[model samples]
Target: MVDTVYLIKKPAEFPIADLISDNDVLILIQDAVLRQPSISNWYACKEDVIARGIKIPDNKLLDYEDILNLIEKSNKVVVW
Candidate 1:
């Protein structure tokens, strides 16, 4: 399992998330999770939502428990 945390402030960082998500599960944490048009079937960290003052659309948001479960199920975890 590989986990990548991208806490940068450049648009280039966005693609890194997408690329890693192609094969591995991408967990968006901190500010990176606030962006819109979130990836399909991906998980977003719950704490990041409140910290960023961003409302995670119901359709795009998942509970931390669910995220944790996914992590346990996945063979790899990537954060960006």
Candidate 2:
């Protein structure tokens, strides 16, 4: 069975990043891909970023495969 803990949907003007831990992983997709948090633990979906016409050299862009790898590697994943 899948074992993801928390799922946050549409966090606007909410500093939800504050709840992130050093071990937590943040996967940004959809409309959430718009804002750029000044943190090293965030990753935006490559396809979504491209679809949004955003070119971000600073943030790491992850494909579906890479996203699976990250989830497999993490003990607990919190999607915000």
Cα lDDT tens digits for candidate 1, 3-32 = 432232322345433465454555566556
How does candidate 1 fare on TM-score?
Answer: 0.56
Error of 1 at 46 (Å): 2.3
- How many clashing residue pairs are found in candidate 1? 0
- Give me the overall lDDT of model 2: 0.65
TM-score of each: 0.56, 0.72
* Steric clashes per prediction: 0, 0
Query: Considering every candidate listed, which one attains the maximal lDDT?
Result: 2
Regions more than 4 Å wrong, model 2: 1-15
Cα-based lDDT at residue 43, candidate 1:
49
Candidate 1 stretches greater than 4 Å from native: 1-12, 15-24, 37-39
